[model samples]
Target: MKIAFIGHDLKFLNDAIEFFEHSPNISVKIDKWEGHEIKDEQASLEIVEWADILFCEWGLGNVVWYQKHKKPHQKLIVRMHRFEMNTIYPSQFDYHKIDKIIAISPYVYEEFHRVASIPREKMTVVYNGVQTEKFEKVKSSKAKYNIGIIGIVPKLKRLDRAIEIFEELYRRNNKYQLYIKGKHPKEFGWVWNNQAEREFYEEVFRKIENSPFKKNVHFEGWGDVTSWLKKVGYVLSVSDYESFHMAPIEGMASGAFPVVLKREGVNVVFPKDYIFETIEDAINFISENDFSTNNNLKTFVKENYSLTNMCNQIMDIFLEK
Candidate 1:
């Protein structure tokens, strides 16, 4: 079977692509749009024609393009993430042309159905899986005091809220520190250009610099998150919203306890004990120093959201008549 993965950002598609690539009966190819615009129309058209299945990673412009150009016999599968629902792209999809719609979580599935009027029978929820083996349990002595936030882009990630939790934790225990992974807003020209986004980040920076624990807060930038996870005893997901936040799951697989802010539908994805209702609740949870459940956390992710499970589920979709 020939499969083509199409998207502007293919980072989340890596494990699924690798799974198919290793199969002797299947061939895989990816065609990434240079940003949102298709730089090479002929190349995209060729891939669309060649593939037996077209997996559109995000329910973005690619879905709109594929819906218009795909052959009648070709199967088109679109995977919708949280951010896309907030945009105009979902309204533009021709549901009749789409064979299947994959939502990363139940919340996303319902949102797409309600917002875009996509038929319920055409949609299915597939939780994002983590490679548990890659993020093996390794912890430093002071790791129990270290908190990690994976991404902080577009301000919705709530880095400011993370600082608030971290501040209170550091007040009680000075050993508590924060390690942020991923790029700064300054790295993205689009984010830096928006006046509101610019001010949001500027204020976030100001808060960090002015805080009493200023020296403890560290922006490590982007690197191997698995390696960084070893130093993080607790992983935080304080996002305003998420389709399915993977960082906390990955942290769990790495044997780090997760302290998540309860966003809408987050309870459907994570355990209640790991989720907090407010900044004070998060601070209190981390202050408890209960690290004995690290093994249980790793087992939870391994059994529930492993890469092998995700690959098999997606492969089943590919082979389904």
Candidate 2:
């Protein structure tokens, strides 16, 4: 099978390529656009012509490009990760050319179905894969007070809300601290280029600056967080929305208990016990829950969200009628 995977963010797709390439009958190629918009029409056309199957990581503009240029015999599959469901991209997608729609979570699939009016048989849900073995480590006892939030893309993630919860946690116990691992707003430009995003980011920054526990709040730019997770007792997901967020699961794989907010379809993606409807509930759960000992968190993710399992499922989607 000749496969072409197109997307701006190809990081997650790398594992799929690596695993699939070893299969004797399969050949994989990636066209990394590296931008929000797909500008090279010629390149997209060439890819569509070359591949038997085209898999787009996000149902963004790239899928639209494939929809325009795709051959009659070719199978086009686009994975809806998140964010795109809220945008105009779904409406722009040419479903006539798309054979199947892959949503990372059931919630995203339902939302996409409602918005696009795609038939039930045309879609399937695939959870985001995590390399659980890579993140396995012995957590330090001192990590008990460290609360971690992995990704901070834009205002929608609600970092300000996280800080508010952190503030309340610190009031009860000064030992608590927030450790953020992704791109800080001060360092990232493109996501916050718009005035509304800029204002939202600035508001979060202002809250961080004014907070009494400012010194305890640490920001480490995006990188390999496998080692760092050992020092994090709790991983926070306070996002307003997410399709199938890998951060919380990754944290769980690394032995950090997740305290996820009640986002749309989050309950479907994560264990219901880990979810909270409000900041107060999250705080109470964290205060009462003991994460010092080892549990089945890693085992659960390894069994369900492993890269090997994800690849097999994806390959089935590609090969199936």
Give the candidate number with the greatest TM-score. Answer: 1
Give the number of the best model, judged by lDDT: 1
Q: TM-score of the candidate numbered 2?
A: 0.93
lDDT, model 1, position 304: 83
Shift of residue 245 alpha carbon in model 2, Å: 1.4
Q: TM-score of the candidate numbered 1?
A: 0.97
Off by over 4 Å in 2: 187-191
lDDT by residue (1-321, candidate 2, tens digit) is 999989998876776788887888888888888675877767877787799999988888888878888888889998887678666788887768889988888898888778777577878988888878888888888677889998887777888878988998899899998998888775667766778888887878888898789999998988888888989988999988887788889889988888899978987778888899899999988777776554888888988899988888998888887
Indicate the worst ten consecutive residues by lDDT in candidate 1: 288-297
TM-score of each: 0.97, 0.93
For model 1, how does the per-residue alpha-carbon lDDT over 92-207 read when each residue is reduced to its tens digit? 88888998999988999998888888789999988898878898855888899899999999799988898988888888989888999999899999999999999999998998
